[model samples]
Target: MFKIKHVLLLSFTIIALTIAGCKSQFEKIRLSNDVAKKYQEAMKLYNKKNYSKAIILFEDLSQKYRGRAEAEDLNYYYALTLYKLKDYTTARYQFKSFADTYPTSKYAEECRYLGAYCYYLESPKSSLDQTNTKAAIDALQLFINFYPKSERVADASKYIAALRLKLETKAFDNAKLYYDLGGFEVSNYKSAVIALKNAQIDFPDIKYAEEMDLLIVRSQYNYAKNSIEIRQEDRYNEAITYADEFMESYPQSKMLDQAKALKADSESGIEHAKRMIAEFQKNQEKYKAMLAKEAKADSTNTTIKTPIK
Candidate 1:
């Protein structure tokens, strides 16, 4: 037991010494003024995949080596280190800077792609703000335009499509919100109609095109139905027009029956409004004729009562 304990103690001492020695070496290198040595060590750490330590050293060497011939290489590695560390926002800026400063470098094309990819990585979920998603699409498209033959072009195109789809989803949801809020304090049905129309114009090939078309028809119908009698005729006619367009566009849509039903209702409402207007005009003419008859009677009485002067 004594022999075994002695061996264990020696092993523990050696492990502690090794750890202390490594920390000491790192500290020494960190405080050293030797830029070349720091660059070499940073590269070594990066190769070992110790990115936490590597990034710090690379950041330091990046400044020390600025404006020198090694600047390009140093900046490239520094940006890569940040990427490997998963500091995507900083990585994006650094990579873009590297690409701009060394446009002719072999790494320039890759850096540009990485910078755009960082924006893609930063994109939020569909329900959240999509500013980063839009930025990603723009950046990726620009990258594709700049490097048509790049091996990464295919990937960039794929990401662009995904980001565009996200935008389409956001627009669709926003328009649907208007539809859901129909008949609120404001004339939200009309708002829904406008929103859906704008969404369709913005995303012509949206997946929900059929659904949106149906919503527009429904919204128009509701808007016309709730409008004051004076406005109902024109509004219902507008609804019928929207229904016609919907039927023509999506002949086989599952909502075809509903859309047709709305059209029929709108037509009925228009005819009813016309009849009401005609009845109102007839009553108004009768009122004017009664007034004329009363005036004539009053004049006859006054002439008969007056002396033959």
Candidate 2:
């Protein structure tokens, strides 16, 4: 057992020393003043997939080679090395810088696409804040516009579609949140209706179109049902309109029956709301007439006695 432990320790020491020696050798190359040698070593490391070391060398070379003809290639490789290291944020900036600085370089188009792709990669899921998702869509769309005939256009279009879907999902979730909160505050039903409508307007090809339309009908009806008497008739009428539109647009929908039922219910609700409003106006008129009659009687009783004067 003692002999085996000694051997294991010796092996570990040897491995650690070998790693240190290799790192020292790389450090010497990195700190060297020979620009050509540094550039070549960096390229060698990058080709070998030793990106961690390659990036350091590339960073130094970037500063040394700036304003020279060699700077273009160095910058491109630097950005690509950062990307390979999974440092997407910096990589994206570097890539954009490369394209902007080298508009005529052979790698400019590729760098632009890569920069946009980095944004796409950074986009979070639908539930999170979607700033990055929107940015990705814009970038990818711009790429498509700039390079309409490029091979990457197809990939960019596909990515744009995916990002738009994410935005749609976020909108759907937001509208649903308002609907869910409707029971707590009836005004949220109105908000839900508005949000769902905006979602449709913004994304005409939304996959959740049918579902969103159904929600709009439900939200409008509920909003009308819970609203004050004066607003109920108008809101219920709008609900009926939405339900009709839904059924017209999706006759074969699995939710056809539900939509039809909502339409019928909304129609009934409008009638009921109109009656209630009419009854309220009638009561108001009666109240005003009663006050007028009381005022007239008081005026007659309080007449001045001229004979006493």
Candidate 3:
């Protein structure tokens, strides 16, 4: 019985309030005046930098007068309040919605700009995942296309460029760690190659891109050339192969000239060793002939001296 009485009272209260709500100043021609008073309070909070409170009041006003022609105005301000308060995720949603709902409004272009800015503001630090940054770039580009004459177009483009540069720097930074760990010069797994490949993708025309390529080639060459010489013939052939690869890759490279010259010197050194062995054998035979002759002469001299004795 008590629960039934409570339900009846709750229904009555809701009906009464709904009636009063329809009769309130909000539902009258003086609605603009009432809304203006409420907005004045919100503006005070906003101007004082109490963005949280301002956002709360603005959102209440926006919801209360949802279908009113002025609701669009209140919503746009509410989005701005959220942005100022650093509530970027919802701010982006609100700004994007406001732009769509009020496409012909004077603030539509700015709404699009702020939508992109909200994403830009939420972008993570460089060390963190850059999904937001990339999203921001895409949104900002869309904003540019939709509002090409918007004052914020340049600013949005600027943010995208900044984000891209940061992302590229992050990629390069990770690649550099490989070089730092000494993995680039001795193994097929050197870091310079990975760095160069990504660097080309991140910044194809970047000045460091060429340098990265050079480092990769140099590391590969050094790695192959310096492999263990357990089998002289095997190792020599591998070295020659690597040296040839280096030459073909960087034919105009200064290192290519040095590599070719080294190969020639290695060949000459091997030939010189062969010639030295042949000459040494010939000299050994000549020495044997001279020794034989000397021994013969010594015997003659010895016979002369001994017989006389």
Candidate 4:
């Protein structure tokens, strides 16, 4: 009889839990349905071109079902609304979340692509922060990698090329900076190579090729002229390196003659400095006697006094 009572108690407990779970589930479904209904109404307004009212309803629906399945579509639409309203960052995150959660979705692909575009659309020109454009390029690459045959592949490639031009502009500017700075050994050399190579890659047939080569020549020439004799030899050698690059990359450059002349000058300047040093060393004894006399006088403990002889 006692065992029977225990069994009866267990049965009652199970019934109570089931009833509670059903109540909880029903509440969730009711809430989700209400939010979904609001989303539809907003979409209808949006279709009717009632953008402002549609935005309000979309905002409400999104808030109501914040963590539920019904929220997915609403979030995407919310992002679109924000984008239309010119609130970029919020739109980007909403689109980002949608993409992450629904990778296989048709809308997800668009979100993934457009999320980066949100950044790109706000991106300034090549003179400004290229951070957004770089990020967009990366995101586009990923999209292409994941969906090779997607219809958006062509569009992604187009953007990549456009962004590439921005990068090219930045590189050209850097090289120009070095040239303007009068080709200081460190700063000029640093930016020149970067700009030259990038220009070669992007506008191989453009005037930048010859322009960069000319810049390299001028800066390197001045650098070799002022450097110490031994260091000058190294600088001349470095200049030769630039000459070689020009020859190889821009064989037909109108600047080739100038580059060759500079190369010849570097070769001769190194030799002249070496010869001058050698001639100096040939008179080393005379220089040493002068220096020794100066050292002896400087090291003397006694001060010179006028002495009567």
Per-residue lDDT of model 1, residues 176-262, tens digit only:
888788768348889988998898899988888988888888888888888777889999989999999999988988899999999
lDDT of 3: 0.72
Give the RMSD in angstroms, all C-alphas superposed, for model 1: 4.4
Candidate 1 residue-wise lDDT at 302:
79
Per TM-score, the best of the predicted structures is 2
Superposition-based RMSD of candidate 3 using all C-alpha atoms, in angstroms: 15.2
lDDT tens readout by residue for model 3, 118-194: 88888888788889988999999999999788778779889988888777767766665565555444544345556
- On TM-score, the stronger of 1 and 3 is 1
Task: Using lDDT, rank the candidates from best to worst.
Answer: 2, 1, 4, 3
Ranked by lDDT, the better of candidates 2 and 4 is 2
Q: Which 10 successive residues of model 4 have the least lDDT summed?
A: 25-34
Residue runs of model 3 more than 4 Å from their true location after superposition: 1-37, 182-191, 222-309
Clashes of each: 0, 0, 0, 0
Best by lDDT: 2
Identify the superior model by lDDT, candidate 2 or candidate 3: 2
How would you order the candidates by TM-score, starting with the best? 2, 1, 4, 3
Candidates in order: C-alpha RMSD to true structure:
4.4, 3.6, 15.2, 16.3
Model 1 scores worst on lDDT over the 10 consecutive residues at 300-309
Q: What is the lDDT of residue 3 in candidate 4?
A: 100
Q: What is the lDDT for 11 in model 2?
A: 100
